[model samples]
Target: MPPTVGERAPDFESLLCTGETFRSTRLDEALDGGCVLVFSAFSFSAIAENWWKRYERAGWADFDVPVLGVTRDGPYAQNAFLRYLESPFRLFSDVDGRVGEAYDLLVEREGMANTTTSWRAVFVLDADRTVTYAWVADDWISPVPREEVEEAVAQL
Candidate 1:
């Protein structure tokens, strides 16, 4: 199961894609006032593209907290995806799925033997790394609850 509200979020270290380059980032070190952590399957999928576009249109960058994305894709693919979207937020490369596993977001799709991907999920964390809010998609393509996330950030 995933971390619940009021619980300390699992800390992780991964390669962060900054559009131009990659850098090692630790979850605890990245926290400022608060942050929204997004976990998704593939960076290049249509669903993922639409997800990022939706956030862009919703003015997600204007929120009080920083938003970060994570996927199992390599840093190279993540860099390209971030560049292509012209996204304001950075993406972390969880290539080994260790981050996903730590967050309990890893899922094995039906009919895809030995293949595991991070489930679509979002976590709002305070500077102390405590989870303020958590949401996991019921299915692969469910849309993120942007308004709720915005409200959560506003409370930070």
Candidate 2:
């Protein structure tokens, strides 16, 4: 199971597309701001492209809060998809699937190898880095609705 509401989110360092990095812990001295994190199977997948495009068109990207996504793909895939969409959003690569496993979203499906990817999921972390919301898919087929995710983030 994923971390539940009111729980402390695990601290993680991710390799971003820019060759820089992002860390999630919100310590008093940390510069990394809080954000709503979304974990997807792959950034360049057709379903992910459509899902994010629709979310962007709806103006949800301008929500008065930080929002980002995590994907199993590496920096190369993310960089290509970022250009293809030209969206300002950045996707942090969980190429090793460590973050997904920590969040309890990595599992072995019927035919897929264990720890190979993450299920589609969404998480809202407050400015203090506590989880305000969490949603994990039972499987990786359907898209997670952006409106529902925005609703959860709005609560913070």
Q: Evaluated with lDDT, which candidate comes out highest?
A: 1
Worst lDDT run of 10 residues, candidate 2, spans 23-32
lDDT of 1: 0.90
lDDT, residue 85, candidate 2: 87
Identify the runs in model 1 with alpha carbons over 4 angstroms from their true place. none
Clashing pairs in 2: none
What TM-score does each of the candidates earn? 0.96, 0.82
lDDT for 133 (candidate 1): 91
Evaluate all candidate structures by whole-model CA lDDT and list the values in order: 0.90, 0.72
Instruction: Kindly list the per-residue Cα lDDT of model 1 for residues 93-129, writing each as its tens digit.
Output: 9999999999888889789898899889999999998
Candidate 1 residue 125 Cα shift, in angstroms, is 0.5
